[model samples]
Target: MSLSFERTQSVGIIGGGPGGYEAALAAAQLGAEVTLVERAGVGGSAVITDVVPSKSLIATADSAVAISEASDLGVQLFATSDVGRPLAPQIAINLAAVNRRLLSLAGQQSDDLRGQLVDAGVRIISGHGRLDGERAIVASTGPGGTDFDRIEADTIVVAVGASPRELPTARPDGERILTWTQLYDMKALPDHLIVVGSGVTGAEFASAYMNLGAQVTLISSRERVLPGEDRDAAAVIEKVFTRGGMTVLSTSRADSVVRDGDGVLVTLSDGRTVSGSHCLLAVGSIPNTKDLGLEDAGVQLTDSGHIQVNRVARTSVPNIYAAGDCTTFVPLASVASMQGRTAVFHALGDTVIPLEQRRIAANIFTAPEIATVGHSEQDLEDGTVRGFVHKLPLSANARAKMMGVRDGFVKIIASEGSGTVIGGVIVAPKASELIYPIAIAVERRLTVDQLSRVFAVFPSLTASITDVARAMHIVGSDDES
Candidate 1:
């Protein structure tokens, strides 16, 4: 039977990640009968385990860090002068309470989203959804040997998000060796934690656990932590981590990880072993593109196991589409939602714009968040675009001085000839929130002069934006002279 989406035709979306749910909402709004099949909960990996829980954990970590800096705000702390007594802070976090609250929040968000979907007239099902054939899905509930139920829809969306990638030798036992997804289940903190891979996820977990009073050792294959981020920002965070008693090992690769009697040992490629009470593997994520009959259904897949899709999220087959972490596009919640909406628009013959990666803003929710918008210095060197770079230190900002912050800075890059802001980076306490304005500038191609014309509150960290804008004047003069 041929797949045809009539007014009363049903549309099926697999995986309940941001992409899947958002697409369901869009399709339902367009008056299409929608069915969403989810193997896990509605929030997917990002909302349930990865992004939301980790960020909530980082919030607690930030509170812990703030206590140390509270002294400058005329707050005094009297250390216990008694002998054989602990000098650590009197207020301690209850790991159990924190974990419970984190899970509760994640569940709440998931429930709220599910409620909205239900109210919007989308049918939700709990089962493993797989492509039975073109325009057909076979979903099985319970364990193996169950009869596969059939779900036929004119259009099918594959939003099956990725799972945490595990190294072969250091596979997670869900106890001594754990993935980031399993960390929220922990009630007791590890005495010492060895985090393998110094990418964004690894660095974030290492920093979070360290702030929560665990001794941490971060192993990086590259020369520095956060190797994929801005170089200067990486350097600043490395210094902060080292100063805060984190053991950072660079240029080291773990060959294998094995659990010993009471701890885990990670042997490096150079034959050196790192021992700790627990080990976390944060290598990266692999797309969940296997066993969905993609090969049989005529959908192309990347060499790295990601589903191959065009800018509008169209698969090789005209009737099929894919989005979220399952695809090769950057696996972000924001990007996933946009892709989902765009996929539906393009499918419906509505006005649809292909995804523009340059306009997307990304943030790393570490203690001091790292947010980036637009092009990078490497982007310019790669001949993707040409831009001028200007950096403004946050230390000079009145608000930063008042807050007792000495680290972090903001850097903005603009096209040399047009003075149009193309990209920017913010490394500060709330860089995640701060990056929005810069993202707007990048998306609109706002000129540096236009950005400078906006009035910024005096004595606030937002003043840093003006500082960067003012520096552009110097850059402009140097360009002319």
Candidate 2:
């Protein structure tokens, strides 16, 4: 059997991130004449700087920690300390090599995507794309340089991802006070890093640098780190980060950051100053919707400047769609990819399934990665649902002991009487991977009994799920939350 698609429709995607690129491929595969326009390199900020680089750095850092754990398994390992070495030579990760590899992988990915698009007859344009008017997009090489060319599209996918937002008082100079995007340009490691804003991005860097042998201080404006995450999961990560030698400044907001001679000083809102070799501002991200002529094109934007879109990625304007971080969606690469695919499906008059927030899973790559799916403890406070939460400690599991693990747990929430799994949290090594089973249960509306019946290896880390399901039964029997 074979599938056929109409090749007459033209689709123009305006970003090269996961959302934009994926949509381009999908649209092209569906037989649309696709044109992908990107100002920067393909992969956008997410792959070029934010997600890929950070995760790769974390991978190397985690390998270092894993090497240290060899002795725990009764195997001896030794390496001369790089400390006390002169800082004059500036020994650290080579940015040229790192960027070469990062760009290489990104390029390979982009090339593969481009090949797929081209094979399906999609055009690749290297430029910034914006609305000339409805049904038209004007492209130029850069901000000002323009051999202006206008392309008319039957359908348009807006995937202009996002950028690091700067504070009015403490704008980044891209040197001392740096945005997360600027970290990839460095060849030398900071002696001490003061990371303001203890959100997922901030906490990940704070933990990463600490592992990379830098004194890291995390400044959180909220009472706890990862204010947007599940409270118990955030608390576990906070404990892990603190125990790993990172100083956490809770309830402290950075008022300003300034270079003081050789080091940078971060002044807090409480009139205190913290000094560090460098400062990373991980406050949040702002959507790149400003220059796209969104207002002129009649695309509705939120107060924070994110484009408003429906589940299928449809914008207020018909025939126009938005996806990825630019839309008012909780930004995740997975969500971005799904949104991209969904937008293309909707644009082509295909059978489009509206996005279900409950089916999505998110992860925070801390020491012990935190993964969550469906309803969180924070959701309960808003009276959105009636459910009960059941938490299981990793310490109680035999596999954790064998792996020399501590300081993590799995929490599951289900409907009060129905016992249908609605949400879950995992804070352990490979928690990101382990959370999927629970997520599948949640998405499929499976019960605790069904989950408990699923076979998990004895003395294995994944057995923790079965234990958690069993615990839920007890919790249900006791009629306790």
Q: Pick the lDDT winner.
A: 1
Q: Write the per-residue lDDT of candidate 2 for residues 366-477, one digit (tens) a residue.
A: 8889999999877777888888888888999999988888878988888878888999999998888999899999988888878887899988878989888877773434
Off by over 4 Å in 1: 1-6, 77-88, 143-147, 474-481
Error of 1 at 78 (Å): 5.1
Give me the displacement of residue 289 in model 2, in angstroms. 0.8
Give the alpha carbon lDDT tens digit for every residue of 19-119 in model 1.
Answer: 99999988888778889988878978878988888899999989988886787888867667568564656657788889899989999988998999999
Tell me the TM-score of each prediction against the true structure: 0.94, 0.92
| Candidate whose TM-score is highest | 1
Cα lDDT over the full model 2: 0.84
RMSD of 1: 3.7
lDDT of each: 0.87, 0.84
Off by over 4 Å in 2: 1-7, 79-104, 142-144, 474-481
With a 3 Å backbone cut-off (N, CA, C), the pairs that clash in candidate 2 are: none
Error of 1 at 251 (Å): 0.5
